[model samples]
Target: MAKILMITGDFVEDYENMVPFQALLAMGHEVDAVCPGKRKNETIATCIHDFEGQQTYTEKRGHNFTLNANFDDVAASDYDALYLPGGRAPEYLRLDSKVLAIVKAFMASNKPVAAICHGAQLLTAANVIEGKKVSAYPACAPEVRLAGAEYVELQMDEAITDGKLVTAPAWPAHPAMLKHLVALL
Candidate 1:
């Protein structure tokens, strides 16, 4: 079993993070979820619109995550791999220099790195997406391309592997993405 570190910030995609996290746990892998806040309970932000275009709010149990570990406090040598769940969280995380350093450290070490949706934004921010093939949410196509990566416009079922980097389009791609990831582990 691999010891995986999952990094997140505020406004993470609920199902996107939970499904894979649970899958990793079910596979007997040790999974640790890290977030920016030390809230014993975290709220995942999701977009749910009803038939009448009314916004509905729903909440689910999230990993009682650690906010105490600053990006600088974490060393890449301690973990086998890293996972970044997508959503607006990546956008915020990208701004943190510490987080960028962590991303660079993982990429430099050639550890297996998995990202979905906007999570790839951090890769772009780390300047590690160049000459790589990747996939992400449609809104991120131009950014990926600008980072000198080939972006594939497929569902997560079409897993992408470029060296140590593995990327999926969105939540729908979790199963296929995780399957390929587990193989690498």
Candidate 2:
């Protein structure tokens, strides 16, 4: 069983963060959900993103997710895999130096990394996916390209795997993303 490290923060998509965490645990992997500046037992609010008959996805208030690990205690090399769930959090989490360093460590080590939706922002910020095939939320295409990665446009329910990276467009691609991710594991 692999020990996984998940970096998450407030406003992370409900499904993207919760699903993989539970699924990995169910599969007998150890997962430690951590957030910058937060300690174990602390909670972060989540948001649900839905695509109703609208031009873009809509966000709604979601439940609070509890953290099981402390960010300050994270040692990237201690984990075998990394997970970066999508949502508005990536927009800001990318600005954290520790977050970028953690991401870089994983990529440099070629450890399995699973990121969905806007989570790709962290990869870009870390400059780890340059020249690699990556799929992310449609709105993130430009950023992915700007980071020197080959943005792979995929269906909302699809995922793409390049090396140890498993990326998808959004929560709709959970099944595919997890499948690809599990294969990497």
Candidate 3:
């Protein structure tokens, strides 16, 4: 089974973070969920984003997810794959130099990476999506393009894998995204 590293932080999308973590574990893969400046067993708050006929998604309080690893101890080289679940979390996570370094390590090595929703922000910040066909929430397309990736617009429930990177628009694409991600693994 592949050893996966899930990098996430507070306000990460509820379904985006929890679903993949459990699904990957159910597939017999080992996943270490970590957050910057957090210790093992510490928890972070999650939020729900629902598209209820509004111009954009709406947010609500979700679960309090626990971190199973220490960010300071994470070595990108030690993991076989990387998972980046999106939400408001990526907004700030992309600003962390260490987090960006880890992302760069995985991308530069061509290790499989699955990023959904706003998670692509980190990839753009890491400057690792150049020439790739990546997808994210509709609102993120501009950034994805600015990062040099051809932003492939996908349906809400669809996912696209370009080389070792698998990307999707939102949590609705979990089934396809996970399938592609696990296949790469």
Candidate 4:
């Protein structure tokens, strides 16, 4: 089974975090979710982001997500792949030196890295998406391009895999994202 590391924080998209976590487990893979300054058993507040015909998505409070690992103790080399779930959390997580370093380490090793929605912010911050074809939340297109990456706009339910990196526009693309990640693993 592949060992995966997932990084998340407060206000992480509820579905983006839970669905993949459970799906990976059901597939016999081990996933350890961690957040900066958070320890095992600690919980991060989550929020649901759904489209309701509005110009943008609506947000609602979601169940608290529990961390199963400690971020300070994580060594990128110990995991087979990395997962980044998008939400408001990525806005701040991208500013963390530790988080950026972990992301860089994974990409540097050419390990499978999966990201969705705003999660692409971290990839841009880590400076690892340059020259790669990526698909992310529409709002992220500019930054993705500025990062030297070719942003491909796809349907919400689709995903784009470029080398070891897998990205999608949102949670609706979970199935495709997971499939690509599993293949890479």
Instruction: State the lDDT of candidate 2 residue by residue for 38-116, as single tens digits.
Output: 9999999999999998888999988899999999999999999999999999999999999999999999999999999
TM-score of each: 0.82, 0.98, 0.99, 0.99
lDDT of 4: 0.97
Clash counts per candidate, in order, are 1, 0, 0, 0
RMSD of 2: 0.6
Worst 10 residues of 4 by lDDT: 172-181
In the predicted model 2, the residue pairs found to clash are none
User: What lDDT tens digits, residue by residue, belong to model 4 across residues 1-185?
Assistant: 99999999999999999999999999999999999999999999999999999999999999999999999999999999999999899999999999999999999999999999999999999999999999999999999999999999999999999999999999999999999999999
TM-score of 2: 0.98
lDDT of 2: 0.95
Estimate candidate 1's alpha-carbon lDDT, on a 0 to 1 scale: 0.76
Which wins on TM-score, candidate 1 or candidate 2? 2
Poorly placed runs, candidate 4 (over 4 Å): none
Instruction: Spell out the clash pairs found in candidate 3.
Output: none
